[model samples]
Target: MTALLRAAAGLIIWAIVFASLYALQGLACALGWDKWQIAEASLARLVLLAVYTSGIGVLALLCWRYRPRVSRRQFLDRLAFAGAAAGLFSLIYTGLPVVAASICR
Candidate 1:
């Protein structure tokens, strides 16, 4: 894929991950998966956290890879940077609530 398209891929994946995690949270609560604990975290919360972390890592790598090319390829660099920003924002906005709130109630 083209660099810009590949950069956009990260944003697209972030959107899917955001939606899936939100739905999964609801489903987990309904099915009592939220109450299923692993260590100090509920199963649902832990799963969400893992997904969020991995997403950020991937996006960050993309950003880093494209960063040096900013002066050479403006469009691709901007797309990659934007994708990273979107990923970070979505993960923080959607994932932080799970940590601050009770998973099931």
Candidate 2:
């Protein structure tokens, strides 16, 4: 049971980050965060960037934590590491558009 949970942790975190960013984007747009500017970028963009950065940080940490050690030669460990890597890739690929694309439109 624990091994199964560990193997799936990366994907679970990815799903959480993905949903949170989506919800935040909608909330920011509805609240008119685009009207507020900080250093030429809209507040919405800044907030999204911060969240996206945080997500990346968390995924990186998970990847590091789950990385296969020399002594831990187990199938589940390898699967967990792979899952973490995949999750990191997925987060970056899906979240990039949110950071680069126009907000509130």
Instruction: Please give the CA lDDT of all the candidate structures.
Output: 0.73, 0.90
TM-score of structure candidate 2: 0.94
lDDT of 2 at 60: 93
Alpha carbon lDDT of residue 16, candidate 2?
91
Candidate 2 stretches greater than 4 Å from native: none
Clashing residue pairs in candidate 2 are: none
Error of 1 at 46 (Å): 1.2
- List all candidate RMSDs to the true structure: 2.3, 0.9
Backbone-clash count (model 2): 0
